[model samples]
Target: MAIQTIIVGTGRHIPAVIVPNSAFMHHQFHGPDHQPIDKPNEEILEQFEAITGIHERRYAPDDLLTSDMAFLAAEDALASSGIDRESLDGLIVAHNFGNVRPNAHRSDLVPSLAARVKARLGIRNPGAVAFDLVFGCPGWLQGVIQTDCMIRAGAARRVLVMGADTLSRVSDPHDRDSLIYADGAGAVILEGREGEPGEGILAHAARSDTFEHSTMLLMGPSYRDSAFLEAFFLKMEGRKLYRYALHHVAGAVKDCLDKAGVDLRTVAKVLIHQANLKMDEAILEALCRLAGLEGAPPGLMPMTISWLGNSSVATIPTMLDLILKGDLEGHAIRPGDTVVFASVGAGMNINAVVYRFPRS
Candidate 1:
């Protein structure tokens, strides 16, 4: 038997607040130059929806911080897997902005979100190391990859990885891209188990292009001039970012598939990051072309961006939780299925993992 790193359980926290496109109607939109946009709010929203396919998103309640959401998701994952919290060998939390309190411009990350989560879970084992990962949107997948390595190296047997982000608190309300921001959390438990070949994680790949694309997404002063000159908000070069993802993200996915020696046609599902509908579609097209497929088979990709918006790191894991629990209609992952998890974000980072469900 071979030791394989397999996901045992998953969970997600979808915030209750629903923010629709109309919610931005009264706000004045602006360009990166800090100049007011000439377009009307309705026209801008219509175009935004057509391009991003996000009609609404979720926001964490004012009282709940990013760590709080991660805790909730961790509880759910532990319960789902029925795994003892004390048995976890490590806890990894992934996020870009640390715990930013409501109406606060500064990030508070002194204790580390992973440490806070480990404490909240009441896991008293000092042997269970806790740490945070800040790898942009692909942070969560990166955590999973790290856990797999740890387990394979005999340094750990069980671990909990989470991705939680409160993008609403950091996004610029004055910028149209603010519509793409949301808040949520998701968690997964991975365990090393004796299993047969072709089980669990098969292969993975990652890349970063900081030389030319580092500023594709960065923090800057609010697009609309505010009295608080010291405050900064998340900003992005939307068109350039889109083009970059379309050009490179698919290549990363292909690299992972090749490493695993798996054919694209055999893939059952592609759990890609919920960045944008059109952009994801283009990436899929690019992947199919690179693999010599005419097009992506229908239902090959399951997405939650329309309602959940872009929850940064939480997107893929949350989508996985939904699918596993039968919450996502028209999607299911059965035994022995091959799936791909891929993401791209602020680091100008991209990663892909190929996994095969245990045959048992």
Candidate 2:
């Protein structure tokens, strides 16, 4: 008998502060002269929205930490899951910069964010394993993959997968991209179950494109591209990363569909990372072309960037929780629907998962 993993509970937590694109309009950024530079205008705001499709995002208060946010989301998931905390076999967290404290990256690597979450949850299983995964934006999905494997191997009956980040903490308030980053956390409970065929994560594709060449998409504190101020914040080669996802990632997704033995046209919904609205649209078009569809599937992809923006690793899981909770308009997952999840992020990592949403 083959075992499969099913999502028993899902949760998300967003900071209280809702920041709009207009909020950054009147703000000043670092200039070449080390002077304040404000690129504010009606046209700039309009263009920013047009290019990114991010209208607003949330920012945690100064007091809240990344682990704090993840704890809250995990609490909600455990509460709703009807699964006792003692039964959780492991905790897997996906994060990049760990916790960021205003302008500085504060990582708790010694203890690991997963262990912190495990203690916070008050789980009784001492032998339970917990760890962190740093795979950029695709991290949460990667965590999902790892947990599913553990369950199938009879290593654990249940696992908690979480993604959380406080991008605003390290974001360069003066940088134009500061508007795209925000804070949030998401969590889900995966339990091993004997399920019908075409259920659970049917197939997956994971790959890394960077080896000898530096992608220069995500970087640490350093001198930014010809900027006067130090580039301690995350930077991206937006155009190149976008093209990589569209070309290489789309092909990977096609292979994932082939591996799953499912036709692309039958995917009920595409649950993609809420990175950029425009890039998501382009990815969808590529999927359509790969599937040989005359047109992209209508209402097949739901978006959160317009409102939630990008929260690093939290994007996909948080977006999934939103749809599951019916927080997103015109998006709902009925029982026994097929879903395809894909994400591409730093490390030049790309992954796609074909899942049969549980019948509940």
Candidate 3:
């Protein structure tokens, strides 16, 4: 029997602070008179807002850590699912960085997070499993695929999938790349749902081009030191990355759809990694041409990328939260609709999964 995993609930937590592009434009360039630059902050903000459809982004205060955001997002996901913590079978946290230095092992993190939730929510029966997957932007998609497999194999009944990152702390404020990255967390509750075939995770595919690994990477102990942070903070060959993402992601999506015996046209929505507005637009255009769609999936376009920039792994679920909140106007998804979740992260990794919304 194929395992049927349904997304029972989804939630996201973004920091209260709204950082606009103007914040960056003004801070970067100064006027000849040694005063503030005369660049039009409004124009910059408006161009970004129009391109990525992102008004503003959220960020944690100076003191808060990534785990804090993860905890909040998890609590909300569980609550929204209406399932008590006691009923959960396991927890999987997908992150690139840890709050504590040297980072605790996965075995240690599971119990720690579980204990935190138990003490806070008053549930103690469910066993907790925590592990860190440092796959950069593709981490969350990997978590979802892993959870689906566990549920299908009867290894777990319910799983918590979390994608949280605080890139700001490790980022170099002076770097253009660092300025684009923000911190956030998003989570989903995956549970068994009996349904017809092809209704859940129909297919998933991933491919990595390790040869391009050096294009984007963090050097040294992979730990943040002052000097390391200053030199190695979020460096990227933007042109190469943009090209690689389009090629690999497109291939991955087609492969997944082919494996599932579904055509691209059948896919109702494409929830791609919100890396960049221009890149996403290009990918969508290519996909539409290949699938022979009259145009992009009617309003099912990419979510906000300009404001949020590249949130690493948190992009998917963060966009999912927006979709749930009715923010994705004109492209409202419905039951039985087939959606594709695709992402390309550092390490030149690309992943794509096909799923069908259950008729509730």
Q: In model 3, how many backbone clashes occur? A: 0
The superposed Cα distance between candidate 2 and the true structure at residue 104, in angstroms, equals 4.6
Residue-level lDDT for 196 in candidate 2: 72
What lDDT does candidate 2 reach at residue 115? 88
lDDT of 3 by residue, 58-108 (tens): 667766666777788888898788987778887777777555222221123
Better of 2 and 3 by lDDT: 2
Q: Encode model 1's per-residue lDDT on 1-360: one tens digit a residue.
A: 889999998999999999999999999998978899999899999999999899999999999999999999999999999978999999999999999998888899989999999999889999999999999999999999999999999999999999999999998889889899999999999999988868899998999999999998988888887555445788899999999999899999999999999999999999999999999999999999999999999999998999999999999999999998999999999989999999999879999999998876
Cα lDDT of model 2 by residue, 109-157, tens digit = 6678888889988886986789999998899999998888888888988
Clashing pairs in 2: none
Write down the lDDT that model 1 would get: 0.94
Tell me, by lDDT, which candidate is best. Answer: 1
Q: Model 3: which ten-residue window has the lowest total lDDT?
A: 100-109
TM-score of model number 2: 0.93
Predicted candidate 2: what Cα RMSD to the true structure? 2.5
Q: Which runs in model 3 stand beyond 4 Å of their true positions?
A: 29-55, 100-123, 219-232
Q: How many residue pairs of model 1 clash at the backbone? A: 0
The candidate maximizing TM-score is 1
Model 1: lDDT of residue 319: 97
